[model samples]
Target: MADLLVRGGTVVDGTGAPPTPADVRIRGGVIVEVGPGLAPAGGAERVVEAGGAYVAPGFIEAHTHVDGAMWWNPDLDPLPAYGTTTVVFGNCGMSVAPLRESARGPVLDLFCFLEDLPLSAFQDKVPWTWERWPEYRRAVEGQAVSVNVAGFVGHLTLRTTVMGAEASWGRAATGEEIAEMAALLDESLTHGAIGLSTNVFDKDRYLKPVPTRLAEDAEFEALADVLARHPGATLQLITRFNEPDNIDADVERFARICKPRGIRAQWTAIPSTVREDYLREQTIALHRRLRADGVDFWPNVPHKPLEPFFNFERALTFQRVAAWNHWINGPAETKLATLADPQWRARAREDWDNRVSSSTSRLDRPESLILAISETGHGPLGISLKEYADREGLHISDALATWIGHNGILSCLRGIPDAFDEPVVAGLFAEPHTLTNINDSGAHLQLFCGSGENVYLLTRYVRDTGLLSVEQAVHNLTGKLAGFFGLGDRGVIAPGLAGDLVVFALDEIEVRPEEKRYDNPDGSWRFTRGPAGVRATIVRGVPTVLDAEPTGERPGTMVGLVSPPN
Candidate 1:
């Protein structure tokens, strides 16, 4: 007998096929039938009337930093609400396993620095009861997660575990250390890790390079050999792609690792900007050439502009610049003192001027920074910094600094840029090798909220601009990602597949405005946004989200690269 039946809906099937009226029946968490006019064999236990809605396979988040959030937010709110039934965590070289007792502080420090997680959250919330990857897997598997989680063993954690604090400072590992790291990775893969993730494009909060940036070629080749031994394992990387030759070199290294073993490699943050048209063309062409040579290389492209709401209190964007690094990374008292120092302010002005003249910095245009929320009388609400600075006859940096000094920690500067070139984005989506979702959902929580990108795509692209058909959009979010990540039985709605699905009305879909929520483990505030028009989201035949609300159900399970369903 069927456990649940979704009746009278237009099934899109996540295959880029046209939608058709069909009834889907689920028995014991697997779809038993997907056909028209099929009656429930035993008058099924529960029935969802998906009439006037599109019933499609649940969306898969291709990249995320939910490694810490999973511990505190087992329900994983705002994610399942956005119709993401599965998430790929441990992205960008950060994970929470393979830690020795001595390496715990440095690993957590690295995570807190790179991912912007609060130190108290890890110290207070995470149990810290496990050391090995398998033990960590068991601990996570024992939890009640709301969405399917497929995690990767982070390269930083493995290196730190093998080499101690030296790894944090980017020291080169010896051959013996490399061998130990490979063995640890193998153990992690043996016990349900999906693959390995590393980063070359990130820096710590102190403006130092991450450990993976200093890794030698021999280290990565050894790790790749371990991945090669395990046939379905993948390599997730954050490569240096600002320069064309840098991109080519990174791809060449990845191709050398993946091509011979038929291993798949995925990279992130392929921006949708008109400014880098020539670079985009060269990168896409390189991707094609690599694929033609039989390397399963894929670049994850973002569907939205990389804009975020930031404030001087905990700004992640400005920290990249050398001048602002001291003020941004210092303690509150130190920042306060520096903000008042005339000499320091003068140097900061010079730094801002230099950055403005450079073509590389996104913080160049003062007009792009608008006041979102504030608690001071320095300027009226909704005024751009450039306008305010011009009216007051002050440099933009000085004006911003004065406002922060007066407002303290209560000023929010938001960058709400115009949308990207729609036709170009549509073309990228239509490309065969480009994976379109890299939301970075659970990271940078305080600075921005990108978890809503899935719903944003559905509302803006499919419903509004008509850049993507509903079927194509659904395929990009679901089937293509699942197939790429080897979750073969879950991305499509077919007989014998997992009954993970989303039901939503096309016209009613909308992404809500961002708001602050103090929901993290230590009561630190982070921006959050919700979704509208999603009727229900089911994971493995259970409704994790129903009627636009979480049902408090956690039927989600851990998925591995080559392992069977958990």
Candidate 2:
């Protein structure tokens, strides 16, 4: 007898096959029955009425940084709200393991920019009882996590663990160190991690407190070789050259390096743009080149807007040129002083005015910068920073500073003020080979209103925007994503598949601005209360979140890649 039954919903079914009306029967955490009308099997313990909502395999956050997120957040509600049932973390080569208990403090502080996790919230509060990945995994799994999570062994952890806080990006791994790093990575993978992760050119500087910048070329290659040894292991290459022109050469080199070794390599963060015709062409060339060489690669397309969030500590550093691009993780007073300096400001403005084109980084704040999504309470959700600052009688940087403190974080969702349309983005998505899994979730949490992006995709993109049909978008979110990452039986709604499912009110799905909920493991505060969705989301056939809150069921396991076919 099926343990649970979900009835009366149109199943989008994640396979891109086509949506059809159906009912699903769950038993022993597996989809035991799927048909037109399955009466409750004898002895069915529980029943859920889908109420004619969409019942599909839950979505995947192919890339996310939620290792600490699960712990600090009780409900584990963030991604599930967006229909995300699983996540691949430790992307961009940043992770918590491989560092000693004594060294975890600096590692957490380095990541504090993307997250304002006061030590008290996560570190100080949660007992640092484990030093190894297995130990860490057990501790976390022991808790109630509403979502299923799989992590990669990040190179950042290896370097800092082996070389201490002074780890730099350029230092070549020694013959001895190479083996040591590989051994550590192997251990993590064996313990349940998916693969090895690295960032050739991360957003922050090498010397900054972050771990991405702390490895040499030799070190990365050695890490690659380790991945090669594990057949089904995939590579998530977060590189400096994410643009088309630069992306090709770097991706080509990576493909060449990984192709022969039977490793899959993919670059991140191809943002949406209509005017950048040449850039899209370059991206296609790179994709085609990798495919032609029998190398597996795909883009983690972030068609969504780019809005980073940070606390006063790091927001102040954004004003200075050297500190902005370079690494600047230090005490609070030093950061504030750097921003206040007139000479520093001059250098920063010059750097911004001359480098990293306004096209990609939105550096120049052109006329094209429109009001996308603002954090202002009463005024507007999406407004041009320049115009808003001008009217408010403050510089853009100053307003950002003031707003961040006032709002707990200044959020901006900017767009390509001109010539942007859905069809162009649909074209990017149509390259089904390019597995869609690039939502910068949890990173820009404080600054961006992306918590409801999945809703936006469902309602706006699929239903109204018409970029793709519900089947197509669901494929991008489900099977296509799982296919790229090689999550064998998941992402498809079938008899043998794990029942990680989401039921949502289609039209009601949305991104909403919630009042700041100051609940952090640390005594500090960060913008909380993400857009609520997921009338019901189940992980491994267990109800983890109901009506958008954790139900205290942790059915998630660390996933690993087995050796591939010879």
Candidate 3:
């Protein structure tokens, strides 16, 4: 890498301290100096004028599901431009490694269902050459990407690898199988895995519990034991706050198992919207109890609301609604047939009416659902579903079906966002035992755009609302995340640290609107956005994105607690 000098900027330093005017110098991917009036070494250094910009450590995407997408979408577009330099993958109990040859199809199905990715995209794009976590890491290290990547070993992947493809879903693991899984997890952690991620709160499109939910207590104990041996490793538990029937028991189980073992744990997430006030209170109480009990646990609160766009072609958005679930997961021929069937419409209307009150889906509030994107320049593109229903003189369920028949099956629907409870949101951001910005970026590419939502913390919370200071926001995005993940080498603009930095004026950046991009390997389209107007995004002294455009440099490599960013 070339030696670079960034001059004429206010340094945030990623420590939550006040900004200071300084010059930062980098040599061979490491920060050599960070102070005022630093001069370039002879004429061999490249100078970047950071006039009127705040130079800060590059942002870290704390939780993501980019395990499968990283292979196909190596550039990780829109993130580098949004000032994100590091990404953690293999979240929500899904990783792309340690697979059995016979379980590949089943694993792909699970990933696609959970992440809302197309099965064809995974089949056509990912190389799938590695079977173990270490081998997966090696393969990833060889690839060129713009953002540094780390991941957790998935419990579902481990179960499927040891137990047969059929047995992993239907029964608890045998004692021998649990031992094999523990050994594999130990080996993964010994190599470079950040931790173990398991899910207990989700169901597939078929409304069946995910495979990780079938894991027994013995399996969890063994996994927690492995994490105990590996210092700084975390136990990420994915829980369902919306359908929180077993939430209390699930959290108690996680704490009871991991806390005694001295393993750090994090769950996704606490509710942040007014509609979920009850859930938010319940979660806060749970968090307080966990902390009182001397547990090292963090509840993840998303900085952005979960405003999802739905389409019939491929989406799990309607999984909670039984009739819609059948239509969504059915074959192409069955999709049109069911939509036109009177019996299906009746069932769908009944299901929409009888949906549980705790359901967060827009099905409960179809009036807030809009007919957003059209596939073929069709009429009635931008209207509420209720308005359309009124105009067509039909029930809401029948109206949606009729609209889809008139328009194409590929058209999309979107839900209007609810206002965030600002005080609660601010509290979550300020709390020490909370993880903010848990955007599931790189997953749910088709259903929603999670890529640039991190910028909302900077744009809305810091600048617009004044809920958080610039220093605090920068610290949460950088230093706090680094400390939590045990990444000691980066996330701060200090001497001897990696030169991963983002430089931009506060007024210059804004999260762009979502647009359709047809760049998938399978010739499919996905929702994407433009940059947030970052002047420069440097990864390890190399400019991955400069002046609002990608420099096409792939300086990022596998990042872990033990392995520094390469």
Native-to-model Cα distance after best TM-score fit, residue 73 in candidate 1, in Å: 1.5
Per-residue lDDT tens digits for candidate 3, residues 1-566, read: 56899999999998888999999999998899999998878777878889899999999998888777777888888789889899998888888777877888888898988788778878877877788888888888998898899888888888888897789888998899999999999999888898999998888777888888898888899989999998889988987667778678888888989878988889867888897888888888999999999999988887787677888887777777789887877787777777888888999989877766655777778788989877777759778998999999998878998888778788888889887797788777787778876888887877778888777888888899899988888888888888778787888899888889999887999988888899877788887888889899999888888988888888899988752434
412-458, model 1: which lDDT tens digit per residue?
77776645767777777887777877877888887787777888788
Index of the highest-TM-score prediction: 3
Highest-lDDT candidate: 3
Instruction: Judge candidate 1 against the unseen true structure and give its global Cα lDDT, from 0 to 1.
Output: 0.80
- Residue by residue across 1-566, what tens digits does model 2's lDDT show? 12678888888888888889898888887887888888876664577788758888988888777767767774654566666678888877777776686557656765554443454555655656677888878876776666777787777767767656654433555678777888888777767777877766544333343454545556667778887766567888876553555666667767767776788766864555566666666666666766777887877665554444333334322322444544134555465456666776566555555554424555455344554433455344455667667778865555444444344323344445334446767777777667555655555444443454566667767867777888888888887777777676678888888778888776756665534555665444455445456677777777666766656666765554532122
lDDT of each: 0.80, 0.65, 0.84
Q: At residue 167, give the lDDT of candidate 1.
A: 57
Better of 1 and 2 by TM-score: 1
| Cα-based TM-score, every candidate | 0.94, 0.84, 0.96
Pairwise lDDT winner, candidates 1 and 2: 1
Arranged by lDDT with the best first, the candidates are 3, 1, 2
Report the backbone clash tally of model 2. Answer: 10
TM-score of model number 2: 0.84
